[model samples]
Target: MDNEGVFVTKRSIKWLATLALSASLPAAASTCGDQGVWLQVLGSGGPEVGDQRASSSYLIWHNGKARILVDFGSGALLRFEEAQAKIEDLSAVAFTHFHVDHSGDFPALVKASFFSPRTAPLPVLGPSGNHLLPSTEQFVTRLFNESSGVWPYLSDHLSGNGAYPLIPHELASNSTQPTTVWEGVSAKLSGVGVNHGPLPAIAWRADIGGKSIVFSGDMSGRSGTLEKLAQHADLLVAHNAVPESARGVARRLHMPPSVIGTIANAASVTEVVISHRMLRTLERKEETERFIRDSYKGLVHFANDLNCFAVP
Candidate 1:
């Protein structure tokens, strides 16, 4: 019963797990094709300090192109570039909420992509309005509007120019089911609002070439919407911002590890990727893992920034 001298090595287990995953990936090419799909963790940190991690962000890649960009928090832009994702190739940009930690890098992405030769309309999608933060369309206008936005020049360049038009798709959800927010050549995005205290947030799920990946944006576990959105997903990227014993304000805004398992189990996801790790959860990772493991039996990983998982 001695729990002493137990050496905990960071990244070892996840490294091996991902290595085995990579072997199943389709033969070398930029495009994933039907043989594979993958996720690139841009930022795995939460709102506050998280060692070297950036805030919540993720990318879904297929056929050598970044098909979807989810969230754009602090430090995410750098990580996005480091991952070599071309904005021109992105089918859409989805935000879980308007919180800075989840949607801060929008202007940067727009500015960066403006320079690219991309002429297609870029879809930006998020939950419906809440008084707590600006609505998705308002968020885009406030940052890129001609007169009031931060980058007025982008008003013409980012939109209405027939080039690099950033189209905002604000989901005014009146139902609990996952609604399709975007559809493209090989990707389809669906979203449903989730409980996040007073903030309007949503969980997103992407079906690419018949494979699915769901992102459980910041949530309080009060709503059953997450389970519906994540149903039968190939990977479930749930936030591990708190532990089983989380209380007070934190518990009101985020779901701990056990709740994550419950949702993952209910949804029947093929894998569980625990992200948005805060200091509290990182310090007790073993305990967090155990809590989730108790409820969900699937491929689970404590994701690190830039980690890639080739979807099976």
Candidate 2:
């Protein structure tokens, strides 16, 4: 290995030791409470499964209430249950795009919400469709509409007093800037498009209790648009799907650690939490941290399944 690789490996060993020590400590009380907003990572892995991390799903709790669910990837439904988060309390569900790894569990979540006792409509937000891609409205319609969908059984049930209604909103594709998706309970939601293959991907930003947190759905590379949308955010949740060494191929579908770091740095975010890891990223955790630390001079964390962080 080269000098940089060797340094990274050494750092990895140190971090692994630290992680071991941290795990040995008694389980702390669930930090989520009425005073602060807490973010629980339901799934931190990518599409692959070698590392045992679940795919992308996040539970954002504001004032001790589950307020939003960002992304619903594979294995997320079970992870959500494991986290013991209430789907009924969610004010909105936002999708970065239509990619399977980022949205595979959506149908399951909707089905579960149908059985919950939520009396209000759950708003769904996603990217607008182009000629090549279906809009968020079309996507939901293709799944839950009455005439032609597998979940048509839900159509009648979701409308009457017995069922939970779903309100879907398709974000404009050509929006000049960030646009609001939902607002309530001292929370405001907005989104912006980012690079993620041909699919029209969106990055969501939520403001709660005067703090801002941005989730960069799946981006193809570092995005100025994302930086603008995430400016001065207290936390930036970015996808760390590949290592810096795999930059060449990863640039087409996901962001490398260095690119993510640059975006976090440019956005002036106070903390960067890297999620969406695959086997390659899991194996080179130190390398990813080192690359990010090189550009971002802020708190950086590698997200794991069931990991929780608080917005102070």
Candidate 3:
């Protein structure tokens, strides 16, 4: 069956029913149990040092374990440590794009994992490359390629000589359809290509514990792939990097509040979490919320570092 049909299936119908029933209850704060699913923001800000917020990063907690890491941006290592997350516990590492603000701390996590007892190959998924950006595999190789990588000392990760092997999966950067990146007993991940100017990018979706959450990553909302992927999702973590008045390159690279609201409303997501907050957007919180509310009337939240949202 087609991807769109997957959402209207009997199982998804029941899932939506559950969300509707739970709509009246408030989502618990920073609480997720062994039987529940939760999303934690490791870094909610963009590439601005003055904001005192980390770059784009997130963690998916399922069955009391940090099963999926969305991105390991700058300063995310400290946040990971503060959250008490173990790199050994992650089922996979998924990257939306290779921007510094989105993937600066990857080596840190790999080095940290060297101290863990894990020996299983780690799956790293990202978008395919273009002339402007490296593919996921190329990006990993450039990090520890033994002969030419900046950190040749850590080449053991690429070679089999390290604690574990690094497995890289590069999804098509132009495909509008969702591509499955990882799947386990209870956790499944998929990504769809998104427009981030010349940079290849993806928007990810995770289904675990019968709940769904979609991460918009950093997209301009020109491809419309995110809406299809986020259809009926329990929650959407979208970037609020630009304000409504933004134009030129800034407007082309990031989606403003209006686009985010339209996508959230179109996807029928239960709630929306506005993250990847930049100083420009943060300064106009009231105006941003007003623009988002013009089209989406559901629960809206402004994210912060270490803030957790239970997937209801």
Q: What would the TM-scores of all predictions be?
A: 0.88, 0.87, 0.90
lDDT of 3 by residue, 38-111 (tens): 88899999889898898999999987898999988999999988888888888899999999999999998888
Query: Candidates' lDDT values, in order?
Result: 0.80, 0.77, 0.86
TM-score of 2: 0.87
- Order by lDDT, highest first: 3, 1, 2
Q: What is the C-alpha local distance difference test score of candidate 3?
A: 0.86
Clashing pairs in 3: none
Model 1 lDDT tens row, 1-312: 011111233646754554455344333222223336788888989878636789999998887788898999999999988888898888888998888888888788888876888988888998777667888888888898888998898897545874768888988633478899889888889999888888888888899977999999899888889898888888898998888998999899999888988888999998778788888777776677667766875767777788777776
Cα RMSD, each candidate: 5.7, 4.8, 7.8
Top candidate on TM-score is 3
- Model 2 spans > 4 angstroms off: 1-31, 157-162, 174-176, 247-249
| True-structure lDDT of candidate 2 | 0.77
1 versus 2: better lDDT goes to: 1
User: RMSD (Cα, Å) of candidate 2?
Assistant: 4.8
Superposed model 3: Cα runs more than 4 Å off: 1-34
